[model samples]
Target: MNHKPLRARRAPEVARAHILAAAETLLAQGGVDAVQMRAVARLAGITDAGVAHHFVDRHGLLTALIAYGGDKLRAMIDATVTDWLESEPDIGVLLAKLAGLYRQGYSGLAVALHAAGWRETGSPVLEKVVEALHAARFTSGVSAPDILHTRLVVAAFHHALATDPLFGTEFRRSAGISGSRDDGAALQLAWWISVTKRALGYDE
Candidate 1:
């Protein structure tokens, strides 16, 4: 089969995206250190210097990486919003969905980014996600209980996020699952399911 030659485009956005996408994958696999400039360039299919030319130094690149992660988290949350709107997910079901999301969505990255930069991207995205969900509870309000309505369910959720860290709590005791690498990702998915379901009143 004759393969068409790959066409190159010099669009700055495209190039920037290449770099960011490369950084994102690296962060997902091995956190920040995995996203060195040279590695990012190589992953982006560009010259090492090309990566530097795009961003002045590793700090700039790191900032971009953080930003990219935030963007990814926001998108993931948005997708979760759509999913929750699809069915009637109660608080428990919502917690399960959120737990699953933290396992896969950008929670780790978002947490890392928060450590680096206090400016909110995904949280606001999550809050907006929560806001949009208010219709589900028969009103558009995001309150503490409205989020879970019961601390027990929230306990199930935090267990998923913290991987059920030892806290001398009975829920923690019963909710224990042999911690897994994908635990956080799973929690994120479940969090979104809860957010949207609660917002739309499907949980009611």
Candidate 2:
């Protein structure tokens, strides 16, 4: 006797979420190139048609993926800010977390998306960081100039973190550090954290 296969029924939003999550896993494991529709569909336990139905095509999928990553990063920044406000203000921890996210293939995705004509009109993440740091500095009795400097410092740090995943090792090697070692990245992050702390008056 032949048995009919069971079909898994999920809401549209649920299916989309599953596909996006699978794509994210593939992206984290092998950059954007690995987030093919077939792979995502397989991982998502859905059909290729299903993935296409949601994202339309590869470009659409990638665009949505980038937006998804941005949302996650925003949430992380918000949580980090809340924690810093409620407890000890640790810029180093926040910097490290930002670096962690970028290193997880989101940096490459951002670069690819930008190269493909995706333009972000505003720097919401940077603005949030600046705002949080400004508040922290103001509460610590830091001078007006120092508090205002938070924007520049945060912007620089954000740029460095975003580019680090793509060029960090080669850049470090060019500066005479071993390319195979992560020591250079660690040292760079430490320096940024120190600079940020000094700028925000957290070093005192």
Candidate 3:
């Protein structure tokens, strides 16, 4: 086990960063359930109540984490857009990266926020985070509807590939999901290309 330093081992600023950093790391490693206050505090070299002082409770800490994660996702999507525009790369490679990037961490963030948003629907901070996400995605080169379609495809693909028993979307599973992830990604790209051809009058 990686032992965390005791609370007396660090300065105040360093200690705070440790807490946030530990929480963020745990969240990335194991999703929402990993974000225990005591665990974060221990990792940060602080008492559990010290963590609570920075955040009201588990919900408050989760809220802050969600905000941080949203910012990261927005940055990722923006970078992906720029990369796509610049290289105009093969759709298969792009789709594969898309599935992998969002699957590992971003979806966990989204799931956390969705639960928080449900509990405290009127929260201004949560509202802004979601609104910003929607605005960022919709305002990108892709139209709102197609962007949504893309998200649905990626999420469905990731969940199924992970053998996540709950997600019922069939667009991914219908491919019968065999061999390499590259192969699955190629299939997704084929689907996207068909959609594009249909939409753009490339196919008569």
Candidate 4:
């Protein structure tokens, strides 16, 4: 298949997008502090001045990145739900996908972004994404009992990924999972998926 090449006039816009994408990855991997201008420039194969030219400053870059992430996240959830609606709509599969997303550390990034948004009194984009996520999970053909169980699963996963190692360790021990912390986390997710599936009246 022949693909049309990007126009030269669009180079600056493409570069800005690359910088934002790199910044988003950094934010996901290490929260706000990791999204340094130099690092983003390096990842995007552009100069720091190039990043600043588009975003003006680190604060400006971060503000734009959060908005980008919120839009991206909402699009992802919407696509997943649209696909489900057209095919075999399985809430269990969607829940498992959400658990996998949490396991990949997106949840930690989201927690950090939410804290920042709360303190800054802004970030309507992130707030809107969160509201949509809550509605998707709790109101999308899920029973009351299933919603309660799903919340329990989310709570457990959140505690398992908590920064307090002692709390996480104790929670893992009480849950009777054996292995390294990461392994225990995987097992916890698996168990929760089974529980959630059953709660949703799925046998497997």
Give RMSD to native, each candidate: 7.0, 2.8, 7.9, 7.3
- Per-residue lDDT of 6-61 in model 4, one digit per residue for the tens? 74544777877888989978887777888899999998777898889999999899
Greater-lDDT candidate between 2 and 3: 2
Q: Rank the candidates by lDDT, best first.
A: 2, 4, 1, 3
Worst lDDT run of 10 residues, candidate 3, spans 120-129
Model 1: lDDT of residue 116: 62
By summed lDDT, the worst window of 10 consecutive residues in model 4 runs over 124-133
Task: For residues 1-204, write the lDDT of model 2, one tens digit per residue.
Answer: 998998868898888788888987887667778889999999988889999999999889988887776666667767766766677666677777777767666677666655545555566656666777777666677666554577788878888878887899888888887845367778887887787787666764
Clash count list over all predictions: 36, 0, 0, 0
> Which 10-residue span in candidate 2 carries the lowest summed lDDT?
113-122
lDDT comparing candidate 3 with the true structure: 0.56
Model 2: residue 174 alpha-carbon error in angstroms: 1.0
The CA lDDT at 167 in model 2 is: 93
Question: What local lDDT does model 1 show for residue 191?
Answer: 54
Highest TM-score model number: 2
Model 3 error, position 66 (Å): 1.6
**Whole-model lDDT for model 2 versus the true structure?**
0.76
Best by lDDT: 2
**For each candidate, what is the lDDT?**
0.60, 0.76, 0.56, 0.63
Candidate 3 lDDT, tens digit per residue, 27-89?
766767889999888876668888998787998888777766666665675566556546743
